[model samples]
Target: MVFRSQRLSWPLRKGLSSVRVKARAKRRLFGRMLAMKPGMKGSLIVVVEDDDSIRSSIAEILEMEGYCVNAYPNGLAATEALKRTEEPCLILLDWMMPVMGGEAFLKARAELSESNQRVPVVVLSAVSERAQGQPGVKSCLGKPVDLNRLLETVEKLCLSGKCA
Candidate 1:
């Protein structure tokens, strides 16, 4: 007897939406050339996001673009990692998370040595408005994040030496 293979329906299939597809394509088109500037390669970036997929995706993208990325599931883990690693050029932080949120993280970050305290942070949150004027936060971008804007912000900060 021969077995037949079955295809999943649209609803059952996993795939990206048109907007996401377009965004990804656009990112691929420009991610390499626009991601880093001269002398920016190997600069580290810390990503603190509770969502696994988002964290991994951001890390993968940044790594492909020649920056070193350290991703953690929450603020606590990221803070711990920060203590052990060389200072990152920038930090992309999420607002809400278990085991430590962005606000608390900022407070903790402020208490670290002066250099650590000065590392630029870009808050990614639904409530980005609340992050404005927060110490060490250079910028805030709302979620779901715009890939273009995110890349632009990273490039600007890292290239301009503002993040250091």
Candidate 2:
């Protein structure tokens, strides 16, 4: 009985280990990057999302495309980061988040001084609602957003300097 139990457990343990290895590899590929340090240009982009995997993937993708990325887990954290930058920023905002939702961020952002208010926010949410009319929102992207569309929107906004 002991030998039989050991054999069964061996296979299960092997399978579990393989799964763990794969997950770790995926994270290593897309989850490790340095945050934009102080004195770095504020013209860089800011990604605000609650999901760790989603935020890491987006930050990795954008960074691979040569964009400087600063990812935050919530709107409040991103807002605090925004206050420290001297230059205008491009923001990719998630609608639902703890510690201040995207809507509140937009409102608070609008109330900020002119320098901070210049940051253009692009909403990224699973819902299909448009964000065109929202204060400080330049556009909206339905999630699981397409990489091409995301890049295009960023380029258009970042290159043209048009957030209003």
Candidate 3:
């Protein structure tokens, strides 16, 4: 698993239509591209979701794959954490939560200092419409997210060392 770090290739950036091809590519490319900072092992991934099971599952999966994860029950908690940590390499953000929704968090994140503003974000939501055209959001994943798809997207975004 490559640390979610770089701009994806064109086909991947547009979205990989061929799962078999992507899987093959993931297998072939992942080893060569594990580019996390030395001693860090993996880049940081922030997950904000109100659903405890969903948040825990995502965090567990990411951790199993070697990424450092911080899971939050709401955007407000995540925002506070992000402010203190290194600009995360990637954020897996859910659309709705009690204290602060993803939109508010995105807006708040953008308003943070220059470095914070550049952090890459991927929106995960049940409402497809609400997930579109979100400023600073690199991609969207529908709820009941396919684990493979989520992994692929994470690899595409993070493996290349291009994340802010």
lDDT of each prediction vs. the true structure?
0.80, 0.71, 0.74
- lDDT of each residue in 35-93, candidate 2, tens digit only: 43243322478899998877887876566555678899998887787778644458899
Give the lowest summed-lDDT range of ten residues in model 1. 1-10
lDDT of 3 by residue, 1-164 (tens): 22221222123334345555446555654553475454333778899988887888788667756677889999999999887887777889999889999989988888778877767788888884686777778888887676778888887777656443
Worst 10 residues of 2 by lDDT: 1-10
The 10 consecutive residues of candidate 3 with the worst lDDT sum are 1-10
Clashes of each: 0, 0, 6
Q: How high is the lDDT of residue 96 in model 1?
A: 92
Model 1 segments beyond 4 Å from truth?
1-38, 162-164
Per-model TM-score, in order, reads: 0.76, 0.69, 0.73
Candidate 2: the clashing residue pairs are none
RMSD of each: 8.5, 10.8, 8.7
If the candidates were sorted by their lDDT against the true structure, best first, what order would they fall in? 1, 3, 2
Q: Residue 25 of candidate 1: its Cα lDDT?
A: 51
